[model samples]
Target: MSAPLIVGSVAYTPNVVTIWEGIRDYFAGSPAEMDFVLFSNYGRQVDALLQGTIDLAWNTNLAWVRTVAQTKGACRALAMRDTDTVFRTMFVARAGSGLGGLEDLTGRRLALGSRDSAQAAILPVHFLTRAGLTPGEVDFLRIDSDVGKHGDTGRSELDALRAVLDDRADAAAIGINTWEAIGRDELMPGALELFWESPVYSHCNFTALPALSEERATPWVEHLLGMDWDNPAHRPILEMEGLRRWVVPRLEGYASLFEAVREQQIGSRW
Candidate 1:
């Protein structure tokens, strides 16, 4: 028999090992027995995927776009979390700051997360541009604590929020996940409040090239989608992975990110 199918994921946190180990255990003795390798960042993971060193890559939205760019749309997005289907970016400022909307950002200071981040950085800029704000119109304060691993987005975005609270920036851009993580509009009356939110987009996905055949891919996807959120044994892993269930990727959900990448002239490679 051939070797187990290999999957690549970035080591974004210590618990990542636990998440994959639990998943590997779940696949034991299945028709598509699998193993995993962790990379330090999405760039290395994408490189491994392209070089055929790994059969599948768990990729962030930006990494997925970069992979598509490199493959010229030859790659496939196999699956994604349910949460990945409706991701959005939020432009926030201190509550009662009188920053009404995207247009209010003109000539104002905007703090952004890492330059590589799609939600906090790329899509935020795209939204600003859509509002007719040019590059020179907003004084951008980029806080890039977590540079490569697009995971742990909270770090940079939280810093951006601090920039707003401390008066360094008039507003900040961050993911909706980050917004919720901070308790949303109810966190505090005088703290952060959302001024504008980008339209929904997709997030992380399992990316594969043509080399990973359908024969090998089909059963794996089937078993993945079978992860029942109600099953006590499956619940922990599902919760840790931040999804109730895995589903076939929504290709259309990536359209905004694709547009943003193209408009920004972002290179195909990370």
Candidate 2:
């Protein structure tokens, strides 16, 4: 018998335990048995991955970029959720704020989430700059809540939205996930509208080091890709993890983020 594959993930929410436990149970009968450990933040998880403390890490876009940089492009992205692709940043404002687009944000107060959040902070700045509104031109009210979680908790995004509602900011940058969640939950019903949305980018993935050989990596990935979205046993985990299917890692969708991180000069260590 071989040792179980150890995977690392951030404890972004309480449900993380349940989610991973379900995944471990699903793999118990498979040739590739698996186990997981949770970290407080992505930084620690990324560090663990790079140090070979774990076989794999569930990484956000920012973490993935940092891992690639730290490894000199030696790391591999194994798989990602279907929802991880086509991620966008939304510029939101109170209805009738007269904010039509990014151009309208010039000289206005803009709220941003955590400094490390790719969609809410980094990419928003990149898009704004491309839109001809430099950071110096806008009054930024940044909320750093859950900075290391990489906006997985959505706490900072909610704060950014609150800033808009309270008139503390004329606009806010948030992830598409938070935007759709607000609609689904009827949060502040009809009080806000999208002013603009950014181009699509990648979000999260299962990243692994090159040292994790195909003998183990191959079976692990095969079992992960084999998860049936239609299976009753797998549906609960899929729903909780916010994906209908696990798809092959889409590396191209991360180009924008890779460029954004470089343009922003976000630290590669963290």
| Global Cα lDDT for candidate 1 | 0.91
Global lDDT scores for all candidate models:
0.91, 0.91
**All models, RMSD in angstroms:** 1.1, 1.3
Q: Any runs in candidate 2 off by more than 4 Å, and if so which?
A: 184-189
Query: lDDT by residue for model 2 over 50-168, one digit each (tens)?
Result: 88899999999999999999999999999999999888899989888888988888789999999999989999998988888766898889999988999999999999999988999
Q: Compute the lDDT of residue 220 as modeled in candidate 2.
A: 88
How accurate locally is residue 265 in candidate 1, as Cα lDDT from 0 to 100? 94
